[model samples]
Target: MALTLVTGGTGHLGRDIVDRLVRAGSRVRVLARTPGVRSNVEWAAGDLAAGAGLQDALHDVDTVIHAATFSPIARRGGIRPIDFFRSPSAVDVEGTERLLACAEKAGVRHFLHVSIVGLDEATLPYARVKLAGERLVRASALSWSIVRAMPFYYLLDRLLAGLSWLPVWPVPTTRFDPVDTSDVADHVVTCAFDGQRGVRTEIGGPEALDLVAFARQYQDARRLHRRILPIDLSETKARGMGFVASQGVRGHLTWTDWLRRNSPEA
Candidate 1:
């Protein structure tokens, strides 16, 4: 079988895809800045920003799951990147453009671009670029789909865990429908081969939760005695790159049900 190329294969969601593909016995090739190979898989070391080693890696693969992202940078007085950088336009727009051009040249069969729920690339710096990346993929001659999704549950779990260091849990007003990373990965693979072209789908967890509620419930379940303080979203610390900030709170999937099934306590 022809191999599937997964960018960011070592990342949370990307790792899920790699696991699924390997379990199904499909040939998998991952592009990494540092090559670390796994059995039944191939790793090509290069940088996507510089377009290094992309061609050599894309040689036999016809489908790509583009999951690589820049870690978000936050600054005071304004979003920090604005001083020394352009928003999503730089990486989401330009970086994706580079990938698309190369993928088109390589004759890839399908391109799957992952995006988030609320922020459109044009409006939110991060959202805008992701939106641009989708636009680029849509405009390409190759088959493509934009997977717009909500925050991943594991993301929230980690955040809550980190906040445990405080005397009390600080909750932001922002709501989240944290989708399971596995669900996202499943759909990613499905889109790659199911041949549903040019479709943009929004996915989320089984239920929505405000940060305070989520924190409180999680603490109760974990049997931790931490007071939960709710704060306004605007007052919350900014999440920088690779961090999933809440853009919207809903998805096709409900986070509540997913949480019940896979709570840290469970």
Candidate 2:
């Protein structure tokens, strides 16, 4: 069997993708910078940033799902003003260039690149960086598909958890369309099997909710009594922070349903 090689297989979306692929009986291999815990699938010791071990990982792989991404600022919690001016990080750009090059040499049949939904919001560094990876895939000689997924639910859940102990939850007047990670995972797996080329149907949540209402629903779901304070996000929105597609292939899971599933108290 021509194995399917997945990059970032241990990451948030990558983990879910790997699970679905394995369940579907596809031979799976994951490229990881370090050792991974999951013993079910084959793990290729590699570093995308260093462009090492890719040749070995891509060997005999017919499908490639490029999900690995890097952003130090986001990892550290929040982005600073100066972060915008600095050049975007390396993994998505240099790593992807190298990955595509190696995949071509290894005769990859299909290259599916996982990307965020808001490339039009390229004013933001993260979106810009994602675009870079997308460009590399499109320009590559291999058959390629890009799945543009909306922000994951975990992002919002983490934001709210930070203020769970506070008396008031200060949320922006801005709006967003976030999808459950598992739902997005379903879309990715479906696309991989469908084997289409070019950018696929953009996916997002069922409804785009206002931040205040979103947080209120969250606080209520969590059985908390914090006052929901709505603050203006005009500046942030102007910078394209609210860049998720207002509409897309809507996910079946609503934010409320997702909260209940993820939070024990909810």
Candidate 3:
């Protein structure tokens, strides 16, 4: 059986990836900052930014899925927390480089990189780091594929539901092509099982919808009616949200569409 190592396997996407690997009968190991209890997965405790215990996890591993990334904490103006903005260089970018180097040493056959769509020109710090992570994977000697996809539906779904407590929800000016996190995980496992390389694929939801449209769909799905207040978005905020929206063309089934179909009211 091949040994697969996944970094940040406790996260939303990482959780899916780890579960998929285990179901496929592959021996799995995961590197996590906070080590806790998980059956069947060999957990190696380490921080990506600090670059410790990476060698232990990579040793004798056959494939690796790089899925860990830092999302925005709070964006106030142009600056953000140093850990959010600058740490990508340390964790996503440098940590990936370290993994590639160790993979080469360990004779790892393939490297699957998890990246976000529209990082090409995104103003957001997370998107920039994702792009940088892709660059590192591409330049490495290890065989690699950069899998880019739309934002996770759960991320948007929960955020809207959480904010619905307010009288009026302020929708972001941008839009999205939200994809299922499970689908992305399936694709990652496909890459691993097929040993595919030199291939770049973009995945997205079934359709496109602006932030307001998505929120309305959520309201309808939950059987709750609420007024949405749309205000002008700052240039940065608009671009940040728009980047994810741009990927909608590559994917289908806008978040609202999925909610409508899945909701009990449907």
Candidate 4:
């Protein structure tokens, strides 16, 4: 049995990948901020920024799934744009370099990096950092796979939650194909076990919809009636997101289907 180390194992997608790997009978270890024991899974306390506890975590690990990230939205309230870039760069770019060095040293065979779909087209700081991380993975000597997935349904749910209180929801004109994290996880896990290497695959949800339509569907699912106000995005931003809307390996779950199954009862 091959040993796999999953970074950001506590995150939504990372956790799902861990679950899938465990169910598939693979030996799995996770690098977390606070490590502890879990059934069929080992944990190592580590901070990607500080490069601590990685040695123990990477020990005997044949493959690494680099799922750790510092998202900009998580710091929306108190963070500046430069700070936003700095934060993700620290983890996504610099931290990835640190991890790559250690993985190389440990003689890890395969590295599966989870990235965002249309990242190359995106201008956002987070996206840029993620793209940088991808480059690092590609440049590394180890065999690798880069999976670029669309925004997760859970992330959309959080967006809906943040805007649900408004009688009128202001939505950006940019389009999105929000995929389910579980579906993305399945792909990630599949790539982890598969022998294919040095491949870049993109995945997205079944349907492409603008933010207004997404908001309407979200409201209908929650049994809430709200007016949706379309906010015009800059042409550059729209074009970039439009590019994301155009390509990818589509997932099984549509936005409506995902909401129907996952949304709270009315």
Candidate 5:
């Protein structure tokens, strides 16, 4: 059946998007390497990197809410300095092109892409890969919308969790405005149905805080005590890479609120 196809449906943000779509009563399909068990949702087994199952996944689909990105560096705990230079050309780059082509062939009406902010200002290889994917979407023949969002609180939460054994919190500090995944999903669904095109203003949480502040709040919420030894990040305003949206609208949830709701210490 024709539906609103969501790429990366198994992911954190993609899962929320799919759930919201299903709850909103839009016929929904999800693209994943393994099929999902969500009721009323059709899961198409597909790998973006390999270009398999895209035709069947996109077939007769009129809208696409894409939240997929490839970053093995992230998957491996983001500690490798060398892996930072690696580009997601195969998945985000080539796979984006493949998806767009197949979607056009299926006569998809709107293609919504999810991206992080500061891709233009950041020199990171991951940013470049995401930019390349955005380019493919913009240049595609199908109608398109790109939603740039701030870093999620889960990112810092995970990073801190991985480093919880450290004696001191020695970390690079930078400005960040983390958003909730559900808020991003809501905005994505709204944009998907609004029928507008082109890149919209970035979206983030209510307040902007640096990495040190975020860490402190996290430690407090998790009932951990560690002295912060911060390294100053200079030269670029985009210190957290794409984590801060330069000028953007704010979502309702704040980092503290997210912590209060999700953290076990709460």
Candidate 6:
């Protein structure tokens, strides 16, 4: 059996992928900056930005699932736009290139990457970096699969949490198709083991909802009494995110379903 190496194994999506792969009886290795022991997986201490400990992690690994990212959302506050974009560029773009080089040298057979839907048309710095990373994966010599997923439910939860204190939730004219991270992990793991080559898959949630409606649903689920105020978005911003909202293969869970299961009241 070929050993599968997963990057960002501690992240929301990556951790699920690691668990699914383990359950499926595949040998799994995780690459992280601070590696630790899992029940049935190997870990290597590595940082994509510094290119450290990667070779050791990749050794004897036939499949590489690149799930690591320096999330723009996590680093957005108090940073210049240029710096915001640069941070992910260093990880998503340059780190991908570095990983690809090492994977090729390691003679890895398959590479799977997780990305967001419609990033090619998005103007966000995060989207731009993800698209660049996708391009790098596509250009690689090894057999590769790229799965572009909808925004995760946790992202919506974070947005709602930020606005929970406000009497009125101010939502933009944008829309989203937020899917469960576990569903995305299922697709990613399927692609990893299916022996498919050069495939790009796009996955989304069961329903598309405008920001206000989405927030309203979230508020209801949380048993909160708050008015949803629609804020007009600039055409460029709306168009970019609109493209993201409009694309992908629908997953099993709707936002409401996700909320019912994950919300505090549940």
- Could you give candidate 1's per-residue lDDT for residues 46-120 as a string of tens digits? 677777888888887878888877645321212343633555354467767887888888999888888776654
1-266, model 6: which lDDT tens digit per residue?
87999998998888999999999899999999987767699988889999888889899999999998887674442224564344457789888999999999999989998887777667767777788999999988888888888878887788687778889877886766788889889888888877776756688887887778888888888888998889988757775653346355678888888888896756
Q: What is the lDDT of residue 151 in candidate 6?
A: 74
Off by over 4 Å in 6: 75-87, 234-236
- Give me the displacement of residue 153 in model 2, in angstroms: 0.3
Taking all chains together, the TM-score of candidate 1 against the true structure is: 0.78
Instruction: Name model 4 segments beyond 4 Å from true.
Output: 74-87, 239-243
How does each model score on TM-score? 0.78, 0.90, 0.81, 0.91, 0.94, 0.91
Flag regions of model 1 displaced more than 4 Å.
73-91, 121-124, 232-266
- Candidate 5 lDDT over residue span 43-143, tens digit each: 89999999999999988898999898877655665556765576658888899999999988889989999998878776778888888898888888888
Best by TM-score: 5
Write the number of the candidate with greater TM-score, choosing between 2 and 3: 2
Residue pairs with backbone atoms closer than 3 Å in model 2 (clashes): none
Error of 5 at 72 (Å): 2.4
Q: Is candidate 2 or candidate 5 better by TM-score?
A: 5
Candidate 6 C-alpha error for residue 171, in Å: 0.9
**Each model's C-alpha lDDT?**
0.70, 0.83, 0.74, 0.82, 0.83, 0.82
- How many clashes (backbone atoms < 3 Å, residues ≥3 apart in a chain or on different chains) does model 3 have? 8
How many Å off is the CA of 56 in candidate 1? 0.9
Cα distance off (Å), candidate 3, residue 178: 0.6
Residue 28's lDDT within candidate 6 is 92
